[model samples]
Target: MVARIAAPLRRYLDTEAGSAGLLLLATLAALAWANSPWPDSYDRFWHTELSITLDTHTLNLDLKHWVNDGLMVFFFLVVGLEVKRELAMGELTDRRRAAVPLAAALFGLVAPAVLFLAINPSGEAASAWGVVISTDTAFLLGVLALVGSHVPTGLRLFLLTLAVADDIGALTIIALFYTEDLDLVALALAALGIAAMLFLRYLHVWRGPAYFVLAIGVWIAMYESGVHPTLAGVVIAMFTPAYPARREQVEEAERLTRAFRQSPNPEYARAARLSIERSVSLNERMTRLYHPWTSYVIVPIFALANAGVRLDGDTISDASTSPVTIGIVVGLVLGKLLGIWAGAYAAVRCRLGEFAPGITGLGLAAGAALSGIGFTISLFIVDLALDDPQLADEARIGVLAASVLATVLGWGLFRVAQARQGDMPGRPLKLDPPVDPARDHIRGPLDAPLTLVEYGDFECPFCSTATGSVHELQDRLGDRLRYVFRHLPLDVHPHAPLAAEASEAAAAQGKFWEMYDRLYERQDQLTERDLIVHAYELGLDVERFARELVESRYAPVVRDHVISAEASGVGGTPTFFVNGVRHVGPFDAETLAARLLETAPAA
Candidate 1:
């Protein structure tokens, strides 16, 4: 089922790949230490008492708390960015595009919660209804990835969206359902602090440290205000700039730049210069300053620290009987499958939306079952929601068992479906459907022969080198080599994506080749001004180009490229496909040219 739900993941986590190794190592390490003589040491390492404070102001917690509450905030912040993006442009952008997921997410969340509540109606675990409703996308998907090639792409994407929606709902429940009692005084002070920060934001003052200080106050308020302090992070995250889209700094710069031109005197030039310069500076700071540290480092560290559960001599039966254990186990296992199925079925019945073809109700159910594999986040939630040590231990065991069961069940169900289909032996099954233009080819034209595709990161030396090669090829072949550039910016390479979109915006003016060349030629310099300078250098009507870039005019273009690249199984930088055939091995100018010539028609 994990394989079916994650066709792409299986390849990533298979024996051939290394990601699965890390996952296995983590899981084995946890289980090994739990069953080892040093289980006590492992326990202490995770649960060790820890504290954070400012002389008069203070916060006290264990190592577990720091991971769950402190680090996970960054995780949620990145999630919020994804949510915001989806709402504006991606999967949830339109009601039509969103209906299937909305239906699926509702069922996925509601069913699990209802099931858990039914199983244990009157216990402390009732408060942890959210745990059952949640699924750990990272761990579960990573596991599913162990299933290679047998799964289909549509199913994988469907499950991915389902898990993402599940995450959003799970986060909401944590903030709303499981909070401390409200404290009005502290809450008010926290509110005031947030207001001060927002006021600064309004005044165009976005230095992060002040926001951090204000956020700390908000966390204190939440702790005192009867709400879980973690909610403070969610609340503050909602207000962060997904991209200050309305306040287009590039356009604002141009407004200043234009004002300077219109002014009759030299005074206008100086004033406009300052306006443009100041706006540019702020924009650059905002864009360049904030990186997604939370998702990559913070989340991984949290997983490493908190996910290390120690079972030792504790039998499954002993653990399962506890309310916390029962709650987590039933909630995650039964809750996920039922909730997702019901939500999706109801939507189709009510005409909200239907599942993608080749993705049946059974497939969805299996995917939902896979979602029940909620070890990572569920374990984290257990730390926060239940105070009883015994209860917490129970929750951990339940999480482990339920997550494993869910993975097996999901994988099994998908396999059954595949087998039934495969049994009809007339023809072999196709893994993925052709790209749907409306959905997949967002902003670009689709259907071109010899579709020369380039996968590159804007920041890599190799990619920078290849861009030149691609341009030369495009220029030589012209219409025969339909060049399509996709961004595969590495997690570590931050500036590459922005540079890609800048080139894309230039494409809006039929200057893709020009802008593309400029970026590659000056690979050493990729600052904001340099990006604009390249546009001007390419004679790409700088104001319009930069404005569109700031406004993300090519997001659809970027997204389409992303979808296409995924379909063709392109994972990293500098991958290419000549007419749908992949090329990963590096080749010199002569060898590649020879192959192209062999495939090329008479002049």
Candidate 2:
């Protein structure tokens, strides 16, 4: 029964729509519950006090506080992990490449707070400036995903980096400006807990339970010290390791897996499992385990608990002229759009950083407008910033209004941009230098009527899946289809270039297809050692293959392929060109066959 329930839940959490849909449902439910006949029950339920006592100390908090201060720590921890991963190994690893989004996030953060402060100059309202500084990552990404596949991956990365930066800015503000009266002893205790965690790390203690205890201790201490306990989540995640599996770790996994496949015994299974577990870092493990929980469960629960604002005539009347409402509405819908666009534009103008290829000025503006769909973090902040019930309700109204407006406006603008771009005359596909039979990797007759050229990365999951479809297409059209493969390794996939290089090295020995088949079959195990093992299985000179790979003997060919791909505007992996024209949509065997047959008469 547990397994049965977990399967569908896991499937639901995997898709962008599933997570977003849950959040939306929760928001609607909250609004309905809040406005229903039994409205006071909404407040009553959330305010029900819960207390924990340890010796002489007792920590008492309402149910809402538990969700905000305790459960939200998990949410913030995931945010921290994403930020660290991006900065360490993802898109923001390069300083120059990182500049555009970092600059945009800075502007995106400051402009809104400044605008909010301007609208609500003084008193209790001014303190709620943090409300406007948030871009709800879930909502923003959901809306973008809903906009369809034309949204460039680079633009998605830009928005992700921008949201992460916004999170950092918001957390900093909360820590610096939002704390109550400080308790020195409790602060010292929190410091001591953090120190203990570092000591455990130095001692090479990887036990989850040990970390949990120390983290809880720190959380309790922070809460007692008048600091928001959720900040501890970010602090702890910042210290988690970021690198991938080490050389020996990968080797061990390969050995164990080989033994398990050969022997099919419990001993081999245990060893292989242990090796596999040891290969990935703690950060990745945590991310894989907890990200879905935070996104689909914790965040939606937070929305359900906090998004229940009683919308009545009095609330509407107050919200219309309320400084908090006006500031947040203006800040999110106007300030974010202008601030992010201006920041990106200025960066490009000043040569600070160039925009991602295929991303235009209008696309950036559309993305900027999308950034204003602030729901989750905006609600979280309003909860923290407002004390008076009326003010809090007004702020909630503002956030909801702004988010709805932003979504509609941003969606309209993006669709318009897509239509405009589509309406322009289509450029003829031009592959430079033509396909050289000697240099290219071919799978079918050279004189085949239709040529399908693929720009692919071996380590990319999509490309690996695409290879299966390409094979199906090959089988379906034995004489009519000619398949050519080119290297276009993406920078985000660390092992992609190496995998491409390995394929090239195999091509040097006339076993390129064998290596290609094995790589895609074992896409999860594309480590260097595994690549060499695959080479050996294909009866290649393993020593020469490894040497050629290390020396990058085929680097020039791979570079040429990448150059050709760029010239043809291939911005992503698994790009397909059929009969010298780019195929714009799905890359499945059925689609390919239909397209081929459709154009066969013309050819």
What TM-score against the true fold does each predicted structure earn? 0.63, 0.75
lDDT of 2: 0.81
Task: List where candidate 1 sits over 4 angstroms from the true fold.
Answer: 1-27, 148-153, 243-296, 308-314, 320-327, 416-603
Task: Compose the digit string of candidate 1's lDDT tens values, residues 1-603.
Answer: 222211222432232133334544666676777668877777788778887778886678788677777666656655555555445434565576468777788777887777777866876766666667777666656655666544555556667677667767877887777766777898888788778877987987645687778877777676778776666765665565443243365457677778776765688776666555455333223323332354345655665676565564565567856766776677777777877787778888899865554566677777788888886567667766777766666777787788888888888988887788667643232212233444331222354334555667777888777766766765665565555666655656667667877877877787776776677777766776789888887777887876776665665456445444554556567876654466646744444455565655444
Candidate 2 global TM-score: 0.75
The models' CA-based lDDT, in order, is 0.64, 0.81
Prediction 1 global C-alpha lDDT = 0.64
Per-candidate count of clashing residue pairs (backbone under 3 Å): 16, 0
| Positional deviation of residue 87's Cα in model 2 after best superposition, in angstroms | 1.6
- Lowest summed-lDDT stretch of 10 residues in model 2? 1-10
Extract clashing residue pairs from model 2.
Answer: none
